[model samples]
Target: MNFFIKLQDKISEFKLQINYMKKFPKIVFIGSTNFSLFSLKELYMKQYNIVGVITSPDNPIHKNEKYFSPVKKYALENNIPFLQPGNLLDDTFLKNLKAWNADIQIVVSFKILPKKVWDLPKMGSFNLHASLLPQYRGAAPINWVIINGENKTGLTTFFIEEKIDSGKILFQKEIEIGKEETAGELEYKLKKMSGSMIIKTLEKIMKKQIKPIDQKNINSLKYAPKISTKNCRIQWDDPSIESIYNKIRGLSPHPAAWTLLFFHKKKFVRFKIFVVKKILKKHSIPIGLIFNISSSEMRISVKEGFISIIEGQIEGKKRMNIKNLINGIKIRKNLFVR
Candidate 1:
């Protein structure tokens, strides 16, 4: 959710993509303002006439006293016209957007716009999605792709339509997802790719030569439902090694995947698993048992093998290597993680 995604194409190809946008006709960049900071800067470098920016209204921060505006910050820094209406469906928003007079709109991470808003631009209103639609379409496509163990995914620029993420694709470039890639990694990859793809799609439109590609039967579509605390909890009893391994890495580095454990005395506690390793199937041991412990290996019993917790953080403690926690905390033998 915090990172950006770029493509894995060659250096020459990247250059060409940037050039395509640099020579685009009038365009408007719309979407979640947080991820647009860097790309907005690049648009200015290319001297593209940014008719306006459409984003959600500013929100309050941690405390009620402080206010934060991610999109507004970027707009003010670059002196671009910005509209942050409270509701995208507001009549005022619709009326004002139409006044911008842009030939096309470049949507990145914004909410689903109404049909009227999507039709504002004369040429077309194009959106950049994190996944190669309609494979992964929903609120959290980047997270679900990595969670499902996808090898290759990329950004897609498509014409806006009434149905969500069901528009005709104008341009797409696939990027390889590493074996150990996390959701954070894929997000960054898609973010960067979308920026360049936006420019390329806009250039084709400038020349009035874009060809819409259908997405109805390209592949089976998967809905990427928003991840919550309930779905992120780790299940130690799972049999497959790959799924268990993914459970740890998919949520790694931010809002990390969690598991229930008992640390001190008989209290059940929650902890986040930061690192884990593969374990070959051996004779079954009691579930959640601390089967083996050594200066070298901190192994715990599972259905088929030992799931050794290499690194983690207790409910409120800072994350540290398991070796350090083992040395510092007094882990009782009868304690268990269920």
Candidate 2:
């Protein structure tokens, strides 16, 4: 009887080990930006079995300065395995990644993965895009949405495909855009939302409860190409004061909307505008004309109305509000923005 009892105990222990092994799937994370860092931290807190992280290599910040990607920094602090492959298709990198035996891969704010890499995982790879899929599908979704004066935006988790951001959707969560919100402010909110949404998505995927929807079925698609220097140049001649305000807010705090300022007819300078307030009353002033200059305020006329320049930075000068900006600079009554 003693021998028989020992034999049954050993069988029970083996079964327990197998069950514990099946409890969590091996997951690999790929990302480089702050958004990726937020999602990675959340997954780590949930005690997910994150096998590895893939991020961009550190870039030179300036003379003798270097900046590492957010994901890389987090992985080092936590002792997580990470790779910063310059070439994703390199054979050694592929072999090492394949050896990890990851069940699924998750990407956020990372470079586009090649087919060979994305297809390595058994359960497949998925990406967390900031905007609703099939819309704002490009490099700078957050900025584009606000630049276009969109009142609503959201996050989308979709399976990876050959085409960029053209994957089938798995989950999404929408949020309202505040009228006065800047791209930087909206980014903070979306980052938090993305972390929670990603966790829920992983759970559903583990339970096999999600149905991937094709992006083609979605209507009213709009593309959000990357923002360029030309795109950031403010066109004061544009007919709408509200639209100009939106543009300023959308690009504020980073790669800000810019315009030309002429102190004298021959002395022109570049100014980056960060914040502006719209004056709804109609103005007969010619477009691009500057007027109503006070010690602490400056107004510029647009096609249909005027805009108060609340905050800006003159070229080669520190950023300041209208009050401090005009403190030493002479303002001509007839001065107009070019």
Candidate 3:
């Protein structure tokens, strides 16, 4: 009897949500990654009137093979109409997008939109950025924040404009960054926290309760450009040990921080370091040289400290813990890293 009563209560709550969402304007969603999927799922669960979805074309995985994006897969499962346009400016694509007759659009983790598309909706479009606006205003904001050893970061919603991430702010929420948080872990936390914030933004916009703040008023802006291969390389001689620690965790699990392992100053192989501990101790060994190697651990000397490898991967081997990596490979003391 208790289970049945709880079930009925849940059903009633769901109905209430549906009734509340009836007043929401017709919404069109644009996104391509897992971060975008979280927002889309929240809106759908609240029974919002999602008119259509816009995502990138299927990505090629191998020759003659392609895979659907996370957003596209969700849209397919829920029977939501979606458009995969190769070019956002294509005539047919624009025509179909316009036909959706969206009252407003919400963009997250997607490409830059041309003005024509952003201006099509009667109510205007807004984008959700992963960082506090006027700072970290570019791709890979999450990664950059952790990489730079920032202790505080936040999310922002702003109107879409010609300049990327420079529009008027709709809403902002500050969040704390854990000292040991990796980029992937922080992203997960923020994505989960975004659902309620998105719902509130839509509610405020519909009620005309928002006073958008121009980003120009904010100062001390820092940019987060797209991370490149060059940026992921680890330099052992970097003066700051904290910087090295931050770099390893910032790029953890994806495009990780890497270095070259030179064995006896002859043959060299690449290594991707996934996890490490920074030990700040005075060391006489040369920087980037492997000072100690045990069956269960590996340590390399750096300026003013040592980097203890907890988890890592060789060029052609799968990721492994230090013990397993040691057992699999012959890591001699003379084998230095660069």
Top candidate, metric TM-score:
3
Encode model 2's per-residue lDDT on 71-168: one tens digit a residue: 98999999999988999999998988998899999999988899999988888999999997788999899998999999999999999999999988
lDDT of 1 by residue, 1-338 (tens): 22322343466687877766454456677865555655666676667778788777766666666454565677788788989888878888888887877778877777778787888777888887788888888877777777777888888888889888998999889989888777777677666665667667777777778889888775566887777988788777887667767767777756688877777866877878777775777765777776576555566677777778788888878898887766765764665677
The list of candidate 2 runs beyond 4 A from truth reads: 1-23
Query: Can you rank all candidates by TM-score, best first?
Result: 3, 2, 1
| TM-score per candidate | 0.83, 0.90, 0.92
Order of candidates by lDDT, top first? 3, 2, 1
After superposition, candidate 1 runs with Cα above 4 Å error: 1-24, 64-69, 290-300, 324-328
Give the per-residue lDDT digits (tens) of candidate 3, residues 64-120. Answer: 999999999999999999999999899999999999899999999998999989989
Question: Of the candidates numbered 2 and 3, which has the greater TM-score value?
Answer: 3
- After superposition, which runs of candidate 3 have C-alpha atoms over 4 Å from their true positions? 1-20, 216-219, 263-265
Candidate 3 C-alpha error for residue 85, in Å: 1.3
C-alpha lDDT of candidate 1 relative to the true structure: 0.75
| Of 1 and 2, the candidate ranking higher by TM-score | 2
